[model samples]
Target: MGQKVRWGIIGLGNIARNFVKDLALVNEAQIYAVASRDMGKAQAFSKEYQVPNAFGSYKELFDCKEVDVVYIATPHTLHSELTIMAMDNGKHVLCEKPMGVNRVEVQKMIAAAQRNKVFLMEALWSRFNPAIKKVKETVDSGEIGSLAYLHADFAFYALDRDFEGRVLNPKLAGGSLLDIGIYPIFLSYLLLGNPDQILSTSNFHANGAEIQTSIIFKYPKAQAILYSGFTSRSEMKAEISGEKGTIYIPGRWHEAQGFTIDRNNENEEIKLPTTGRGYYYEINEVHACLSQGKLESDLWSHQNSLDLITIMDTVRKQNGIVFPFEE
Candidate 1:
């Protein structure tokens, strides 16, 4: 552990670029290396980010002694393998969301991190957002009374994209649920914890990929309605209702810039903007955990990742959405 945390990025995709931009915002972090299957792409990304090292393969980046933690920004299907590999090579990991395609894979990734005695976290950036933090604080402070219900949705149009692309490809575990739906589901889980019963249904594309998913999480005293789809656009709003009043997170709630809290028939809007693309908060969490010599984040623990994936697994099973590559 040096004065600055050395970061190695395993993928140079759009998300990876955004993450690097936020990395620059963290004074204790630096992009030490980057890797891509294509040497040219790796070299170009390295040069663009002013990273000192670039590797043609992920293994090289994992083996780089200068690198401390590796950010796994590859596709959903590759997360488990790459994360375990990085941990095995004596490097910590901050894997991109969904952690893995299923609970089984998430279990393996967590085991690897524990065995290697290195920190590991799922990059669920929304959990680290200031708006989300405030929402939690308000709820816990009894400002909203007892929670009664919640509704959230995330939807977009992706039919125009290539069918073989990551959003539509079955091999990549592509689907609205795992790709974008997780946000709504996560919000429900964050506020209500795991549900007593989960009822779900999905609409599939011609290629057997799921395009839309609707879930109803039933709790003892509350319920959550969640929806995610790729066939059309949605308001992307989230609402939390309680006995006293309600909290409204406007469109794009997952990465929301602000939220409205209504109590006693009076609505007040609270704005909490991000420094970058809202990824800096999670990066800061990683730095804090590693600096404390902890192998898992208290906010987004390994068990938390496993629980989320298990919920998705149940939803997928109920909806009969199975990826082609799954055994």
Candidate 2:
């Protein structure tokens, strides 16, 4: 626990770039190091981001004594390994989503964090988005009444790329479900607790990765219709219907925007502008937890991560999609 929390970026991907850009907005955070499999890439990213140090390998970043935390932006299959490595080296971890390929991997990561007595969280950055926060607040205020159903989807076209790319390759744990699907799934989990049952279907590429997926999550009195895909584009809008009224979150609903609440007597729009890409909020949460000597974020707790991935696991299982790492 120091005056400033020093963080290291583990992969030089697009998400990492967004995260670093957001870190600039956090006064309590400092990007001290970056690591990538390629030394050239690592050095380039460090230079671009003005990070203090660059490492040719993730292990080097983990070993750096000055790095208080590691932001894991590696692929889904690598999340468990890199997270455990950082935790073993006594560094807190902010791992990217679909925290693991399965429940077993997530459990191992959590075990390492507990054993090391360090902080760990799945970087489901959407939960910290300004728009989503306002939606949750409105629902909790009893204005939304009893939740009836929720619908969300995230989709984008990546089919024309190399079949070996991460989104289509089985070796890298590629699939729409893990890549973009986790967002809508996470939304459902946030608005409604884990459902009582899940019915999922997906169209698989010849290589066996899920290309598109649709899920129906059934609860006692509520339901969620969710979709994700790599073969097409979606509106990316999210809707939550409650007994009293409805809340509409605009497309890219997970990010900086607002929501409109339709009540019995009136309709109102709420706007929330975010700093940077909104990853800054999660970084702020991490800094606060570390400053307070806490091990995980209350907003995105370990159990919540487990629940999200568990739901994903079930969806994948239902669709007959399994990664090589799982076997």
Candidate 3:
């Protein structure tokens, strides 16, 4: 293979660990460095991943000349800052989903990448998943003919976790909307494009963080109903219904391994398993972009990130959800 894309992880959280595990599966990728606000945690993560360097501060990892890309797995509030920092330092970036708390931050991030002439992408990994890709292909093929409706839900019971933690902390931009709602919203946008009209409502925790959110995207020819929450566990299934048929993605649809299509009352399931937590697909996309000297992924382009964030901003506004951190 060509030169491995040296990866530097800026957060040592569980998501970061899972991402590194999948990174290991990519031949064109290597874990070069990791950082955490806590030096001990950084050291521990580095040792566990067999990385070459560890730092207590994110800047140290960002400055590593050997690091080609830095994956920002920090909280939603930190995504914009770290992405801009990494790109400003001449490193490419793959920031975790939501990309930013709102549209303004995402715009700044995209501009920074352009000004610095470095690669950048929002790590909406589900878009690259094998099953999701197949779903897209099936939809585009008109097998589900004349799409009429789409329904998706992503939720989990998180009330047991720390109320002041990221899941329910407004300071961190925590809420069902940014945390898990983006998946269903993304699926809608991916399949139907921007909605002509959007309707949204949210139920908030006592701490001002949203506990549950319901959104409806009205397209010229279709409608997508989406729900997300931390108040309870949902089946997490997604269904795409058309005039002639319907496709069902089983529970935990975001990481779905298979999907069933029902046409004229006949159901068929197609299995497409992913290797390792499904993060490897996006990692491979980053590898391909860097290898081709591209600054952004064509599959999940900057425009797509902008559009997604814009949709999110609208939903938050409609539901009266605003983070304290936004200026």
- Sum up the clashes in candidate 2: 0
Of the candidates shown, which would achieve the greatest TM-score relative to the real structure? 1
lDDT of each: 0.94, 0.90, 0.92
Model 3 residue 243 CA deviation in Å: 1.7
Residues forming the 10-long window of minimal summed lDDT in candidate 2: 256-265
Error of 2 at 182 (Å): 0.8
Alpha-carbon runs more than 4 Å astray in model 2: none
TM-score of 3: 0.98
lDDT of 2 by residue, 36-155 (tens): 999999999999989989999898999999999899998788999989989999999999988888999999999999999999999999898878887888888878898988999999
Give one digit per residue, the lDDT tens place, for model 3 in 1-327: 247788999878899989999999988788989999999999999898898899999998888888888999998999999999999999999999989888989999999999999999999999999999999999999988978999999999998898777888999999999999999999999999999999999999888889999999999899999999999999999999998899999999999899999999999989999999999999999988988899999889999999999999999888889888763
TM-score of each: 0.99, 0.97, 0.98
**Candidate 1 C-alpha lDDT tens digits along 9-113:** 987899999999999999999889999999999999989989999999998898898899999999999999999999999999999999999998999999999
Name every residue pair that clashes in candidate 1: none
Model 2 TM-score, 2 decimals: 0.97
